[model samples]
Target: MALVPMETALQRLLEDVGPLDGESVPLKDAYDRVLAESIVALRTQPPFDASAMDGYAMQGADAQTTDGELAVIGEVAAGSTFSGSVEAGQCVRIFTGAPLPAGTDTVVIQENVDRPADGVIRLREPTAAGRNVRRAGLDFTTGDLLVEKGHLMRASALSLAASANHARLKVVKRPLVAIIATGDELCLPGSELGPGQIISSNSYGIAAAARAVGADVLDLGIAPDREDAISALVKQAVAAGADVIVTSGGASVGDHDLVHKVLTREGMTLDFWRIAMRPGKPLMFGRMDNIRCLGLPGNPVASLVCSQLFLKPLLARLGGRTFHQDIRTATLGAPVSANDHRQDYVRAAIEERDGQLIATPFGVQDSSMLRTMAASGGLVIRAPFQPASEIGDPCQLMMIG
Candidate 1:
């Protein structure tokens, strides 16, 4: 089969995926969830004219002059209203958020007034009308849009929704991913190792990647390199209603590579296999009805690279969230020789010097080394069939976390 380009593979994977159904959740539980509908203000903010500062509410004409004197008739705090109206020579003592007294158009800050006697105060400074007063609907009016659809709920967004009188919100359902690991030589972590046995580590990284994009993961444990064992887990994934099925190992043409055979036997229609990228050239993608199946390479670094390049975007689209690769331009810190049929994603350390980003690739480009992959900050992207380059050459990098 001809190798598919990386862009073509990604475009095919995200062709028909979309957000799942909406579910109603409490405002407290809606954090980090994608909004399914626009939120409208239920009631006007500040429902009525209120005081913005601790001051005395009175008629503007009565407090305009520094020599004015007024009698304080009543006091109003937050959540309380004054029943009596303010006349020319009368004022009401009001605190922040308290409703302005009837017939009062201004609030004179307490600092600008002096109390000469009980219930009597003299203005020390001229006060302007409508000063320190929050008019009705100052933040939002009734029936106004507070938050738009497809927005991710953050701390501020949740607080704003609550202030808009929304106790519950409609959010898109999180996409579910089922992961299966297959290898005869693989054993669970912390197990006594036999000859030619290694711990299964791909599922852990794959699950973490899926959850980082807000997708729920179901780990199906390890399956031996047998067609029946792999097929059983695939059926279970379908029964559990997984939106995507990710399988690690057994994707190449080796004798033990049984994922492709089992998935095809289970009625999967293959989309493309064997991409043109280095380290992850054996990657596979297909669909078994509504469930999307992704076959990843056995090498640790290859699997992770494929996940960062392909799986993250697919899951983000299915979860109704936006995603874009953090690709940046940088200069090579050392000389590099290139010319190959496959695209390369060389793991490198990035540093900034004199406002220029420098990418220094590791000595080895092995796909099975997970420690080097972890220590690297990003991958320097190299196009196919490029000429050899010297030091300080311009390069593009994809940042990884």
Candidate 2:
């Protein structure tokens, strides 16, 4: 079968998967969550006109005289308000954040005045009118939009919401992904493996990939290459309320590839059965009763690459978060062959030599080689049907898991 184009597969998944419902969480716990509704401030900041400095609140005109002396009638600290009016030559000692007392239109800094034995201070510098006062609602007015819906709450955003008198926030729910591994040749980690069996390793890598994008994963363990077993696991995944079900191995056309048959039997409408991507050709995608299903190939590297290409974005959409791969342009370190139908994602180690990104492809591009994939920091992309290129030629690359 022909492979599905990259654009078509992404569009199909986005069009079919709906975002999960919103839930209310405490303001302190809302960090990194996407907001589901706009947040309006319940009260104005600097609720009352307040002083912004430690100074003596005085009338500008009263300090213009030769002596510049004014009596400190009262002391006002933060949260304290003075109702009495300031007479022509009277002043009040106020701390920072204290409400500017009634009848005081200006302030003279304590450093600029002489606090003598008598309760009086002199203006060492010329009085500047209305210089140290924070006007009412200086930060934000009541009923103003502090944050909008779909905004991802970060440290600053959460603080702003709390300052707006909100104790809780409405946020999108996290997506739960169910993972199932299939193959009779698979054995659990740390088990005594028979000569023919390999460790069931794909689920761990897939689970980490899912978590890196904020989706929760439920590992369903390994199943034999039997239609009954695969079908039962698919049904369990559906009943377990997984927003996405990722099945590793058994996704291709071999006789033991029971994933495709079981998913279809469980009502999955196959959107696409394959993709034009190397090391990951059997990348199947579909939906079953609102739950997304991704049938990933058995090869370890293929499964991981498919997760980065497809699974991340799918989970991001469900969780109401934005996701993008870190793709960059770089010059090849050595000559490479090309001219294949599948677009290749060659494992590579990227480096910077005098600020230029140099991508060196690994010697072996086999799908089952995990050591090379581990050593690689990224993938150098090679287009389909392109001729072999020499060193220093430009290529595109995407950062990996």
TM-score against truth, every candidate: 0.97, 0.92
lDDT of 2 at 196: 96
Q: Residue-wise lDDT of candidate 1 within 296-341, one digit each (tens)?
A: 9989999999999999999998899999999999999876787598
User: Any idea what lDDT model 2 has?
Assistant: 0.87
Candidate 1 has a TM-score of: 0.97
The candidate that wins on lDDT is 1
Worst 10 residues of 2 by lDDT: 60-69
* lDDT score of residue 370 within candidate 2: 90
Q: What is the lDDT of residue 170 in candidate 2?
A: 94
Clashes of each: 0, 0
Per-residue alpha-carbon lDDT of candidate 2 for residues 1-401, written as tens digits (9 for 90 to 100): 77887667778878856568999998987888888888999989979888888988877676555365778899999988887888888999999999988898777777878877588777776766787888999988899999998888899989888888999999988898999999999999999999899998899999998988778889999989898888888888888899999999999999899898889888999989888888889989888877999999999999999998889999988998889999988889988997588789999988889998888999899999999898888998888888898899998889883
Give per-residue lDDT, candidate 1, residue 147. Answer: 89
